[model samples]
Target chain A: MPETILQTRALSVERGRQSIGLPDLTLHAGGTLALCGPSGSGKTSLLLALAGLVRPRAGEVIIDGQPLWRLPEAGRARLRGRAIGFVFADYRLIDSLSVMDNLQIARASAHLARDLDRATNLLERLGVAPLASIRADRLSQGQMQRVALARALMNRPALLLADEPTAALDEAAGDRLIDLLLDLGRDEGIATVIATHERRLLPRLDDTLFLALPAEAVA
Target chain B: MIRLRFVLQGLLRRWGSTCLTIGVGALSIAGLCLIFWAQSAIPEAVKTRISETDMVVGPKSSGLDLALCCALQMTPAQGLLELERVQARLAMDDVRPFVRMQVPVAMGDSYRGHRIVWTTPDIAPFYGARLTDGRTWRQPLEIVAGSEAARSLKLKPGVRLTSSHGLAADGDAHDAAYTVTGILAPTGGVLDHLLLADLASIARVHDHGGEHDHTETAPHSRVNAVLVRFTSEIAQASLPVLISDSETLSAASPRLELAKLMALARPLIDGATIVSAIFGALAVMILGLSLMQGLNRRARDFMLLRFLGMSRRDLALLSIGESLLITHLALLGGCILAVAGQSVLAGMLASHGLTVSGAVPFREALTLYSAAVVLSVLSALGPTLRMSIARDDEELRA
Candidate 1:
């Protein structure tokens, strides 16, 4: 009723020669979901499929009421750029550029105008306003993780795909990032799907999809 | 929609390798340009200098030296030949019909390392030299600077520079302050660099103060060389031997001696061509390897970009654009180096009896630029492809 932001019906992600079938699931606006799995359990792959980055082998993926992979390549790319955001565990920021430029690149990738006020507000919220002029490579790991989170939210996407976004941070820092992510998702009506193994953060999310490791992936 | 700044930022992220590749590329491009320029220009300058003159008649001397000294104005004359006596000898029964025009040149003094040719004003039209500035020299102390000579020596119509005693720059400075009365337009030949003066100028410089010897016509003065035009090919074949039979006069065909000179330099030219090809290949390899060496880091960056919702095409463009920026930077540096290097090369060659035209080879440069770009694209193809295809879940991270 709140309008599904991310939905999958019998979706199976194509992982090279193998395909892993997924259960039917739906997440409404402002909701968060956890994808719990061991290493190589296709969590990252499922996130990729849901974000329209990779083709699903079967069934359907719907983001914001539009069928993913049914649109033309450019249209799909446009949708992904405008409607999706991604975060990395390693905080992938171009090391040479300043923190502000990293956010500008995110806005540029979506063909969006440089909203300086919005970027400044986000950096201030992340407590990184003083670090905006610093190069990404010079930042501490916690600072880098915050700056990366700011870049992810730069485009104000409808859905967020994060691959262990807080894996590299300390427990307290990770807790702070998870709190900021869930609070921002609720305030902005953004649906978030996180691929992570940390159990402490699962209770804060609205739903969880536990992907059991296939036999071939265990050993 | 990904900005070029982002593309360039990624390049500067690895500035050390970027600068190295560009440095090598610039040097290679400059070397290639110089080789091509010298290969084409030297023979061209020689051919144009000897285009009209059939034979060089000077005092008994080496044909190579005579051609280089008399026609190209490369060196000072070894000895002087009597002009009146040579004309008298040409007026013989069988030789008079074969002879055409005769222009005498007396060379000895120099100004700022530039040769001073003391001949009549008739020598101006003979070498196709036209005045671009003030009039031809009317008095012994007045002189006309060639186009290059004026530019290099900074001579204008009113500028006064002293001439030296010999062709070398170290010669005794003359007390006579020579006035630059005119400047010659560029002929792209030897005349573009020579200082043309009248016979009286040499007579004054040599202190041969007979006043009659100051005239522009047959002044009964000895000249360093006589440029001869023959009416028929038969004379060209037999006249140099006939003239050389005399004890004091020697004849050398300008075309024949220049051929021998080129044939002698052919091996060096071939060797330069081979070395340039190798250097060019190596430069391209360094460029490719520079890109290849950074692939892992660049691929990770590109993976981040792709994940950040940058489209596949934008990702590919970002990758290719990175290499193109390096290439464009190299081109700018190479062009500056080539321009500076060519002038230095010209000066070095001039020191040893050769002259080069100062003209930009625009078409050849354009060809080289296009070739360089094509090579750059080819060299970057694999890396760009790898960047676009990089993935966190598949190839790169996993």
Candidate 2:
């Protein structure tokens, strides 16, 4: 069995009057794990906690044998750059920059050399190479999503995190994105975790975890 | 790379607001540039004229007033010295006097209602003047017209013109027509508006009879003032005392007078400059607020950048870069506009018979550029700090 790339124990997050908890979750290396839940089901909160972007109220997130929250914010940021990639639900591409500059910035942020060949290869594989020089503002929603995905993979991070990656796509496009993501993760031996409410994608996932609403409210 | 794109995209997306900020910043910077150019140019110009005379000796009144009248032709002297007494003083071993007799101003003259000054040949060399056409007055009744005077009077060299007694149209008639012997080049000084001739010509116009005869029995001296030069360095200190002790004479020093005048004027200039700087500060503050307000709209973009692995430091650098870019571009634009405006500024000064030197100092330009950079940095401070401080885990969660 591969080593665990991400492990969380007794994690709790609070926002305003609400709080969510997930106990004892671990994502092993070189696998695809799907986190499925309804809206406000604490799916994003869990992902943010795992990515070291959010500070949990209790417990800790351990990645590669390092306690993520125990490190300083800057150290966590560096780890995020080096060790993980993120695909946001909204496809948050910088609208002012060209597609190529966006990819280059991601590589640079990860402290990787800006390799045009690598960016081009990723764009071509993601079917966005022809639109590389165009501004992000000019791209359609699906195109921006692909570019976002390309940017996330630019640094070849050990782990990839996706937040509702297909929320804006049609059924056909969503299935294709999931297939591409799963195939890419398998081919690259990269650990992948995705937060979604789409039950349709569960059959494709190697493993699945259900994050239900807090037990008191559901009852 | 992504961080830069995000910053640039954020700027472009809000083009209207950004341009407005840049425009306001540019105007403030332009105003500062104008002040910078004028401050350096005015003093240097005044100093250039002052430098031409080693010393100015006149009546006991303000030294600056005497210098302005005698050397720069800006103001008239309060009193005059007797020519013989002046000549006797100049006879000293170290004293060299350059005597000038201002045409006894009668005030009521106008050729077709344009004011004309009746003055002499020595007025040209006394102020280091040159002729644009023809020659200096060689005979009584011959006139050398100032540039504006010639243009207004429509008188060329050899053309004859008449005058009234004063600047007014109803002043006494001179009867005899004075011939234009020369046209002076533009000096951008008081001389640009006067008519030049021999003192004798002015006396003749007033029909005061011959020079020595008119002076010997006359109730008053005809000359307005005399400018003098000294051969020895020590003469300046000694001469004023000597002249002041005389019953009929008092002396003034141009250098001392101008210095005193400048001392008095310094605070006013500094105050006005401070006011201008405050306006610039306000502009920078407004820009900062604008950036801060816009930051809220750009939060999603910033979060995306952060998610792509941009550190907080990169965000700060991006804010600074935007400010610097706007400021430097505005500074360059303001300087070019100032240069273009100089001629109009010089013309306005010339109309008032004030000479402002054409040369703008490099230091002034440097100060302007420095102020722009400083203001840019100051404007960026609020936004940079806010962005840096707000990059916490709670804020990024959504």
Q: Where does model 1 sit among the CAPRI classes?
A: medium
DockQ of each: 0.51, 0.37
Residue B323 CA error for candidate 2 (Å)?
2.7
How much native contact recovery, as a fraction, does model 2 achieve? 0.53
What lDDT does each candidate get?
A: 0.79, 0.69
Docking class of 2: acceptable
Q: On residues A1-219, what C-alpha lDDT tens digit does candidate 1 reach at each position?
A: 677888888888866677888778888888787887667777778888887777788889888889988986667777887889888888889887889989988888777888888889989998999998898999999899889888988889899888898899889999999988888888888888888878777776755443443523421
Q: Encode model 1's per-residue lDDT on B1-398: one tens digit a residue.
A: 33777666656767788888788888878777887788788778678877778888888899888988888777657777788878887888767788777788888778878888888887777777799889999988888988988888888998888887777888777667788899999877778778888887764565535532322223328888888888897887788888888888888898888898889988998887678667667767877777776666666776666666667777666656767778888888887888898889887877754677655478887888898888888778877677566554664364
lDDT of 2 at A129: 95
Best-fitting candidate, scored by lDDT: 1
In angstroms, how far off is A185's CA in candidate 2?
1.7
